[model samples]
Target: MSPTKTSVAELSGNGQLVYGCDYNPEQWDPAVWQEDVRLMKEAGVNLVAVNIFGWAELEPSPGTYSFERLDQVLDLLHANGIGANLGTGTSSTPAWLTTLHPEILPESAAGVRAWPGGRQAWCPSSPRYREYALRLVDEVARRYGTHPGVRLWHVSNELGCHNALCYCDVSAAAFRTWLTARYGTLDALNSAWGTAFWSQRYSAWEQILPPRITVSTNNPTQLLDFHRFSSDELLGYYQAEADVLGKHSSIPVTTNFMVAAHIRNQDYWAWAPHMDIIANDHYLDHRLEDPTVELAFAADATRGLAQGQPWLLMEHSTSAVNWQPRNIAKAPGQMLRNSLTHLARGADGLCFFQWRASVQGSEKFHSAMLPHAGTDSRVWREVKELGHILEKLAGVAGTTVKAEAALVFSWEAWWAYDQESHPSSDVRYMDQVHSLYKALWENGITVDIVAPGSDLSGYKLALVPGLYLVREQESAALADFVGSGGHAVVTYFSGIVDENDTVLTGGYPGAFRDLLGVRSEEFLPMPPGQLLPLDTGATAALWAEALRLEGAEAKASFIEGHLTGTPAVTRNRYGAGNAWYIGTVLDPQALRDVVAGAAAEAGVAVQVTAAGLEVIARSDAEHTYTFLINHSDDEHKYPAPGYELIAGEEVSTAVVIPAGTVRVVRSFSSAPPTTGRISGLKDDESD
Candidate 1:
């Protein structure tokens, strides 16, 4: 069965905002279940994700099952107005199952099998594990198939969190089989992997093993393929469980994804189509000097993963999370700001990790809807207020964010660009992408994060940051997009390699050279603390390409460096439009200038360029909802006058968005929302 692209709220038993948290009734005594539901009603939680990590409780002994406690929990939730986002308890393997069938456990890269105590300890290719998982899912679906309280079927708790890759013998066999299916023959595999370079030729399928830690550096292509295989292996598990649940129940099936820059195990673009509605688990990187920008980036990227379909915010923190070294509590209104930010980016449902704080567990320190301090805490107050706000903003459910610009974000490129053998070890993919994204974000120029194959028709300008891996079709699409009057910015290190991690040999950037109209022979990397001056006054640092313009005119040139007279940035008039090639990593201000200039050329306006405010726009057929959120400690004035949604007043002037507050304004719209999605961009647009 294929997954349908339906809205979660529509598919949900109730059509209200899905305000909920992860409910673990098994963690506390069954006596506490009633109190939990009572508190849930007070907080306006309509849905609760139940039994996510309850594998041991569901199957205490091998082939022996008990749903007694879960039954009571479900009944109590149903007795109240709350419904269950039912989870199949397959996230963790029961100790009994591991004790009886230890072969199901996953082996790490060092070839040591993970212990049974941790969650996600099973290998993806283990037949016994799959057999046990399918049985558990079948039982859960059969019992909850027609239950009024069951709103959706959750396949597993964060897929590929721990055991994303296993270098076990089972995985080795599976990898060989996958290679055979992909390459068809050993000769094809050898040619694609470029085995002749290191005399690492494979004569037979059995010779290939996972690119584990070798004596020196393992083959880069082999490691890249292994990353692809590992991601696909984890995705295969999700597909299998989802297929089983689909067969047994009518509820929409989904798995929560940790869709952030830190979690790189699964390529969610491939995993998104398998889910009925995209659901993500995002935790702010507290280590970041400011985590708000990171949060916005994740939300935008997740919205892109949904292909414009409304997704669910499966989990976010109420305050500090348990895993970070310094778990700082959120300030008074910061929690409300965080949740609404996701809503502004197209999240139809807002939920968190656990419903109540755990007194004793690995996640005991993690904050919940009702924290460890009970219901009297500020966290609880904010939770109640956010729930009320979501209830009131029901009309924002099906609306979509519109942007004349897009930032190209590819997971395959992320994997390829960050490999060990890159030209410069200092090059980080996400940092570069964020530099451009943050620049546009600060300018209030909303951008949709798009993959290589996504539609470029709606977006007048597309920004490609460090696209290290370029597929054949992807290159052609960009070329076609430019030839037909679409402006683009192809940054440094883009179009260097193919889908198989093979370099395009003629010049530095292979397929994009013609479109960009530049040729580079060598890379000039600056030492730490060194900056190369550009004509734009903003310095370039970390990386500089020795660029020679072909058909393009030099927009900016390096003022100092070995290639001091060479072009640092070039602009080419391709067909009806133009493409800008930034040959080096520019400083923040320089990137902003370059991007802003391109955006201006494309007629994309910078709505708000304030320091601390984040402005995003969502639209329907008649009205545009512009959200002005103040992330800074100081107050910010709203630059435009419109009817404020939260304040319920018309602000003609002097509208100050308070610190850590969000103000959504409903104003008249002249244009409709952008039509079609990145996935459906191949369909021609009349406009």
Candidate 2:
């Protein structure tokens, strides 16, 4: 049966704030429902995510069911006029199920079968597991199908906690089935995995084995297939729950996703076609102040999953989280500031990691709306204030934001890097992608984090950093994108392998050599503290690709290294556009120069010129909203002239915003023109 349509176009009837946080009333007494509703209303919360982990409470026995407490909670929320995001509560199964069916237990990478203790302990490939979970979901839907408070449906929470691998017999059988469907025969599978090298030729599907602890070699092709198998296994689990929910409920359904999570590839794109709305959690290390780069990257990634449709910011920290080394509370306005930043990017809704602080558990110290000290705390006050503001700015919800540039981020490359038996251990995939993201954000370029196969037709420029794995089809797509007048900037060590992590037999950069216009014979790994001076009078560090020019022209060269005078950067002109190759990791200045040059060639507009300041714009057909935030610890000046949205005043002079402050500016103008140069405007200018 076709899945139910739960897309934004269908569910977002009104552009209002869909306010709520994950609620675990099962942990509290049902008698406290009245006070909980009052507190929620006081905080302007209209939506509550319920039953996220209540499987044990709902179904204590295999057939026995209890809905007395759940019904009361639902009735209370409905009476208080708060909407509900109903969860299937299958994230954590009951102890009885695991005891009765031990086969439902998951197997770890070490081939050790995990006992049922924490959540996500069930084997996704087990028929008994799917049968019970599907039945529970069906029961919930049949009971709450027409509930007035139910506004949305949420499936299994954070679905792949076991990292999607299973070495159990059931999973091994399922893997054979999946391989048969994918390759149709053992010969095709053997050839695809390059099994000839290890003398591991498969005679039949039954001979095939999952990549468990028994496999220890550094075979990229084997590891890649295993990762793919894991992702597909988890997808089946998500689909199983979704299929049942779709059959009975008209409400939209979604599960929270992690940003740039390497375990899942463009698999989310296929899963996106099933979800009505996409939601994800955002958590960064405390050492990083401006997670704007990561947040924007996530917003774009999730939006790409739904084909540029807006997504929900399902979980973010209201203040300090206990998981980090130091649980530092957000200084006064930082929580509200970050929430607006999500909205400024592409988020339609804002919700925290939790509603109430856990009294006891691993997450006991995590930040929440109601702290352990009750409603009289600073965190509580800040939450209430932000909730009030969201109620006021409900009109800004569902507005579309326009981006001029896009970044090509692929999870295939992520897997390829992890599988690389490389000479250097310091090279990381996420770090490189983050570097490019930071550069774009620092330059005030609105970037869309895209998958390998996304359409680059709408974007003027696309930046792909550390593209180690470029599948044959994706290579063709990139060529087509550039061939049709789109500028692309690709870095070194890219296009070296295929989707299965098998290296292409040709010279380095494999399928992308012609498009990038350079051939590399060897990768020169520089010693620590060594620097390669560029012809642009800039220095680069770490590794450099020794290149043989093909159809490209050199833009920059190394001056002092053994490969001196060799091209450090090259440009190749395609049909109507150009592809630039960066051969080494450069200093910030060198990277800025190279990226700026490409941006200029593409004619992509910069949104702001101020350093340490972020500019984001969201608009509808009639109005435009701009957010200018100062993330630095000291005061900063905003040079661009514009009218302030919140204050309703036109700025003829520079405005000085103190550290960690933000200003909202709304314009009636169709587009806010921007200059690319970094302004030398001082923070004390308003004095």
Candidate 3:
């Protein structure tokens, strides 16, 4: 079948920032619908996500359905010139279906089936569940496929967020079938799994099952395959629904992904191709850490998933979420900053989780565009102001964010690194990856989160950290990238194993041993809080590797330890470029120093040198738009002068951007000019 083809502009109300929230009219009375429409029009909301979790309302009983309420909401939105992102409402099943067929419920690893109290209670691999879910989806699509008010079709909401893995018998049967297709025979499965290690070889296809609770620990290979199977099962369900929607609807279809570090089960790289437009839901971790840097990482990753196309910010919170332990509301102006940040990266649309605050539910305390305090509250005021800003910044809808640096992030590697029996239980994959990404982020460098198969020709530097598992083809790709004049920086625990989690035979860092020009004698996994001295007057902690130079030169050595006088860092020159190896975790200052030096050698410019300011550039064929956001508490000065896009004021000298504020400047020069007036603000000229 041909791919689902639809432009993002068509989905966003003719190329404006689709500003709206999840609207559940069924939750409120019919009289309240008028107020909802008035408040939405006042805030400049042009799109509304309707009936996301309305299975209980749409289908109250088997073969019995009702669309009286949804029809009214759709008519009301269309009359007000607002578009609707229609939801199939199959995220949760009705209570009657689950009660009649209890086998549809998923079971945990301990063999206990979940009760039908929460959402996502059905097993994805169950045949009965798929049959019923698709029936409802077909009805929804047929009813509103050709409606003029419908802009897009939103499939199931946040797939695999809660029920990613099911250890029921149904899932086991599906897993066996999947393995048969992958391995072709039991002998091949035995060899790939290395079953000879513990006398745990399988002789028949019927012997396989999901990795349940064992006496001690399950086999690592078995667990890895289970993770892969679980992700595929959820993707299968999404594809089934997308097929139904494609048969009747011409609008784009998308399902939001929980694209945060907290969610690791779904491989978004594999899931991206199935979406006509990639959408993500992100939430800040309220643990006193700065969320702006991590938010940048997530945005870049989402852009990469879109393959440089503009994606959608499907769901984000205006304030604190009620689900957290201590829910603290966002400070003033933070809502505006957060919304602009995603747009500055590559988002074509900005949306919140909810439109109005709920009166009674589990998420009643969750803040929305319209809080319970009417339009007089702080959240509501900020929401209205942000909507106006989005209307003005419509020029940024179709442009692409440009980044010269790329970070190699592998979901397969993340899964392998998280398994048991590693060098150190303290080594967190994302923590190390964030160390490199945060360093560049602090230095005002924009980066793209590239995976193993991503195109690397456009980037100047590629940073790989905590890549414990690497395929042979992936190794060859990185080698070709560096040989073709791309600089690379590789960290420890990379290239040690293949796709099957099998260690390489020759030495440590097997695949990249030649490219990085270093070989490890032994791994020095240190305890927490213990620091090892380095030659650069910096301290290394958490883990270290005793290294010897092969075709590389040592950059730093351990001062005191069993690996004293040994190389802790090395650099090697290849055909047209160079590769640097970081054998140990460097201090924050040392990391910044090394990365800045390498980037300068590669002729990569640092747009903003100030510590507290962030500058992201997005461009079309004509103009480059620079977004200068001050994330710190103190005021910072921007050196160059440009025309501020928002205020339409010419900045001839340095301007002071206050705390939690944003300034977008348009630059006309093809090459970055040192200092000049940014003149292009007209719509025709900017594009």
Candidate 4:
């Protein structure tokens, strides 16, 4: 990826697909800055995020600012014809500020203060922290508000990635304030919290504290509200920072989101509206049972945040991440598969965690586009090759992901599932969500990971996987989906609680009992390694139920179990569509059959229809680009729709994508035009 020192003229991608990476020039010598941009240009890189953790460098002391190094970096990028995604440099609190005002530091659930060795050490609700952070942001915006290379503003890096839940006194005060606004009256708060139990009623706002380390289990509703209040406080921090940027800059503002599996704090569905462009940071945790499926799920979740619009892949690893247990490096061709997978799902901009691998710090072992092995490494070659492929994907920039099914993905439900008491400790929310998504993916169906209560009109099928908490309005929407001819499958442990974590009174699966045309009396959570056989030959594990069907017919009944002859899976004819219910967690293979059955009932066509072969299409009004990725070890033969973009071959016959490789074809045209860029600030909007 060595550059030829070409004085290339550039216009900031000029409608081409975005190729970017997080750049950390402060780690290297100033002399290397020249070669960094030169190589970036040679690799077809159009954007570089700068100064993400530059707080200490920018302001070495209070009221003293320095931007000499950042100036050189941005100038080099501008000279090399690359756009700059300028960071606010407030992601981490400087040691000086923390030392002066230690009250800004966050406290853990156990009341231990988080030290400064880690990033995001400040409390989200700390006023002193906000004062210092916003001051730095305002200075930086005033300095580079209209810089030609600046295309976007990167607000506080991966907000709440580390310190989302703080149990400090400041947070307690802020939580009380948020509660006052939410409940409006103390009596209403007491009633909603169900304080009649254990004499937990509140007399005044001052008596309330965060659900910290308690002698016994804290009230579930209190814990839920604390999670809710924490998310709102984090969002409030971003809004305040973004408002500062808006005061001085007109360029669109953005913050990288942690939309992956591990992070479950902020409700992105609520935060998506504040951004000009939604962006997300995803790192492969190959340690997961299935990382590939998780990748697609996260990407689709990000696109869902944008309402099916093309968004940015703000950060992902080139190969291995440093934080995982084994830190397994990706094999040959796997990088291409991972990058193109995100693009296929709807990421217009493809960027890694970093441009160059770090030589110092804790993340020095983390893989980057340019590894420590330099340009001679396979990662470097793949980075350049990915840049070239992105150039070919220029037509895909404005295209949006196409999906026929909507998987109800709710953050509130996730937060509620944090309860210490549940039917089975093994019945994880992610397990159900991932299994359903994996089933759909293995069968070549792409699903939009949408929040509950979203419009179900466009989707033919809806899958609710462990929606433990649903608002009354959300329950109505799912009912309306079935009434309006949309097929739905509700799994066990779903629809039991409302938004406040209050159990629905009538039956076990309270909210949807009538809609499901069934009633359950008790939970029959299975012991570890226990398996129950169904009459239809499918096996269920981890859960079972004691129930009786009211109107729905049994699709499969338990043949040999504690609840023998009971309806394990039931299908109810509800209005124009069918509503199916699974009373237990079926094995992955069995779950696939159930999901396929629902899809067939809804007439949703499976794409590749083969295991390990993922086919998803991103289409515009003019044409569609189909991405065919072979994650399996064997080659695949797929009928070509049009010319293969990556290979640059006219595929009149079937295209053979070898093991661990990916291919894209310009498929069906005239779906819909999804081409629109967020307009920049007006002239008067500039600093």
Candidate 5:
């Protein structure tokens, strides 16, 4: 079901906002389960995800099953007025299954088999593994399908999170079957892959193999197709399980998406439409230059995946995560700030990775809603406080976020751009994406992170950064967006190739040469630290394109470099609207200037741009709900005329947001509701 049909209210299953956490009862004694329920009710937790990794516990033997403990857990939750987000328990295979069928174990590119001690140790394409998993799913759904305690049916937990790519013979055969369906014949497959090079043309379907352990560099097109196949293969597996659940239940089903900065194996655009309610798992990656900024970016990106519907925060840490080299605990109020940031975007449900901290395991140190320090800890107090706050803001459910601007993103482009051969090693795809996104983010210009080829008619401006792969429809959609009077800002390295990994031969940036009104013959990637001076008082580094403008006029030129007097930036009056082309990497200040100028020309206005103050709004036809977050050490005040939801007070001029705190207000202002999704975009748009 789409978000339009299944709103956040429907997802709540109890007419209240969802405050949830992943609960592992099998890890504890039955005595602890009762106490956990008491704490959950006190914390306003209405939903709990259970049996995520309960395969071994559910079915200990081949045909024998155990339901006593699960039945008890579900009954306990139902009696407490809490709904269960029931997992199919197919996340990881059990040692019993793997020991009987070792052939089902996944193999690495080097042909090393994955061991059973770890999760997701089976190959995705193994038929025997699928058979055994589906049997469990059928039994679980039959028993709990009509149970009043069930809120949503959760598919396998975080599909393709750990073992996305498998190089076993089972996967190889599956890949061959997938290719035949895609290309029909070996001749067509060879042509699409450009296998004519290096005398690698295939004459038979049996000659093909996955791009694994190549002598030198593997075929780029083959590698790209393998990635596409891998994502599809996993989606097929998810659909198979979802089909079984659909047969036995009326409940909606979903799997948590790994849309964080560090996870890229699965392309969520291909997975979004399949979800009943898009849920995401995000852990703050300290390795990022700025983890907090990336956290906000991830939330917006997940909203984009849901087309702006209310999603669930499936798993987030209370403080420090178990992973990462240097795990640092969060500050006094950082947890509150982080949780509210997600809520400010589009999350209707706030949940953590766990209910209680594990005492032993690989993730023993992972932060949970109830930490190992017990109820005396600060984490537990804040967890309860957040639950109370959620209860107060029940009216915010089913409301949609509004944005007049969009940032175009593509997972296919990321896969291709991250390939071994590129202009420069330092020129990463997300770097450009972050640079543009941060500029819009800091300026308070709310943006919907959209996939390519979407309907741009609803947006005033579209920001395209480093989308290296452009299919026929995607290319035409961008052209139509600009021709139909929508402003566009396109960065370099975008539109360089087609879906088949074929370089457009007429000129560089083959896919969008005419739309950009510029032609490039070659890419001039600079040294790691080399900087080229520009006429606009900005320095360029990492990448510069050797180009010639046919109709576009130069906005900035390289003042000193090998390509002196060449165009660094160009502007084209394509149609009723304008398209700005960036041919080289620009500094943060320069990039922000370009983005700001384009936003201004497009008539996009912001509510606030104060430093350390972030403002986001969700609305219906009658009222607007504004979330004000203060990330700085000092307090800040902003004009917001409405009733404060948390404090139940009315405000006239401004609301004072305390340092490291958040405030949500139900404004008296009236705004139009969304059309396609609460994401505020059109319905006809797709990836």
Candidate 6:
């Protein structure tokens, strides 16, 4: 069978302002149903996500069903002309099912069997759990699959949130099966895991155990496999739910993914092809974060996973979330500006976390459309205004934006870092990746965050920061990428391990040592308040690596430290391309210079040249759409002329913009035709 091709119309066919929020009428009185529908219409709400946590209400007992309340909820929504993103209500199993089949409860990483109370408490690998959960989904789909109000199928709520790294008996059995499929024999498994080191060779399948306690201390190979198994176990659950839902309903199906979610190993990327559309929730502590960085990360994650297809911003707080240490209300106009930011970054739909404020539970204090106080509040007014504006700009929904550069992120690298007994505790994988991304965004470079397996032909430069683990297969693929004349930047701790998280026997950076052209003998973690002098007559800190040149020339070296004469950075040429290796976590200024130098050498071009302003573009054969976002809190003026998509106006030099504002622009030219010169008119000589 041919794969389904998703397009602008198919993604946004439901119409503009596909406004939706999670609704639970099960907590409200049936008499108030009509009032809720009236409130929805008044706010211009067109879609409602229902039955998210309705397991307790729908199936209170084994083989027993109740649909009176659910029927009224769906009927009222359909009668009001509102569409529904119908949920399967299998996120949390009912108490009765848990009491009957105790095996359904999940086991924690520490090997403790948890009782069924909180959400996502079920053991995903248990057959009994799967049987009961699949039956419930089938039952729900049979009843509501063709309901007039249902427009999309929400498979499960925020999957892999709780009990992510389960190592229960059921999971243990499945892990062995997974291992058998991957490695054909015990000798193959033993060889892959390097089990001879600790005399931990597995003589039988039963001898192999999930990495819970023994694997963490005895073998990094087993621990890495355990991580892989845990990710696949959760993915199996998601796929099972999708299979059941797809069997009955042809409507688009999706599950919300979290930003930089580590528990699942880019399994969402693998699942993207099976989904009708992708959706995710973005929650950041505004006090500690630059809004630009947070939004850029969210958009890049979604765009990367969907391969440039517009995704849904399924959940965002209307005002303040209760979980942060200090729950502060959004500054006036902040929410509105952020909503526009999402659309400019290629979001097709906008939805909040909730419709009505909850009166009970962990999220009761979170902000919602209608605050608990009632509809006359400022929060409600802001929401209504946003709804109106979204309704007006509905035509822009499903539009594609263009991008120029891409960043390569690998799950194997993530696993590699987690498994490695790092030389320093401060060498964090995600933090390093984020640091590079922040720099790129600040320089107005459009970036696409991509997985290791993705094709690298479209991008001119691919940045791989902190790639500690380079799988054998990936090494060949990356070799081909660089061989075809692509530019790649790799940093410290990269190429240190293989797919099994086993250290490469030859040197520090195993397969890539030749590509990077440096052989490192030791890594020195710079203590706080310490500095290392570089060959460029610059100082850097945080950490440093001492290396001897093999083929590449040193770009920088330490100056003040005991290992002052060591190489801190190096570059090597291979095939038709080159690789740059940064050996330490340098300060922002040094990193900026290194990245700029690499981009210059690669001849990569960016859409904009302003600091703190990000320009991303997307195109087909005919036209290209560009997104210009002012990520800083201070006002900025543009120095070039471009047509704005949202305002339908032209901007030239001296065009002023407030903080957090976004401008969408369009162009007709193809790749790099106007590389050096600004197209049309100069900033000073416009119109």
**How close is every model to the real structure, measured as TM-score?**
0.95, 0.93, 0.96, 0.95, 0.96, 0.91
Candidate 4 segments whose C-alpha is farther than 4 A from its true place: 1-12, 668-687
Candidate 3 wrongly placed segments (more than 4 Å) = 1-5, 672-687
What residue runs in model 2 are displaced by over 4 Å at the alpha carbon? Answer: 1-14, 260-266, 287-292, 325-328, 637-656, 672-687
Best by lDDT: 5
What lDDT, from 0 to 1, does candidate 1 have?
A: 0.82
Model 3 Cα shift for residue 249 (angstroms): 1.2
Which wins on TM-score, candidate 4 or candidate 5? 5
Question: Across residues 1-687, which tens digit of lDDT does each residue of candidate 5 receive?
Answer: 134235555556666678899999999999999999999998888889999999999999998999899999999999988889999999999889999999999898888888889889888899999999999999999999999999888999888888889988889999999999999989899999998899999988888888889778889998888888999999999999999999999898989998877778888888888888888998888898878888888999989988888888888988988889998898888888899888878988888989999998998998898999999999999998899888888888877788889999988899899898777888889988888888787666888999888888999999999988999899888889888888889999999888988888889778888888999999999888888999999989988888889899998899875698889888888788888988888988888788878887887863334567777888866778888777888776766667888777787756777788888878655444221111211223221
Ten-residue region with minimum lDDT total, candidate 6: 672-681
lDDT of 3 by residue, 35-114 (tens): 99999999998889998998888899888989888999999999998899899998887899899999999999999999
Candidate with more favorable, higher lDDT: 3 or 5: 5
Please give the lDDT score for candidate 3: 0.83
What range of 10 consecutive residues in model 4 has the weakest lDDT sum?
Answer: 1-10
Candidate 4 clash pair list = 621-672, 621-673
Off by over 4 Å in 5: 1-5, 606-608, 671-687
Candidate 1 backbone collisions, by pair: none
User: Pairing residues by index, what is the TM-score of model 1?
Assistant: 0.95
**Candidate 5: residue 326 lDDT (0-100):** 90
Could you list the CA RMSD of all candidates, in the order they appear?
A: 5.2, 2.8, 3.8, 7.8, 4.9, 3.3
Candidate 1, residues 209-288, lDDT tens digits: the string is: 99877777778778888888988988888889888888877877888988776888788878888888889999888887
> What residue pairs are clashing in model 5?
308-679
For model 6, how does the per-residue alpha-carbon lDDT over 272-310 read when each residue is reduced to its tens digit? Answer: 676677787876565545654767677777777776777
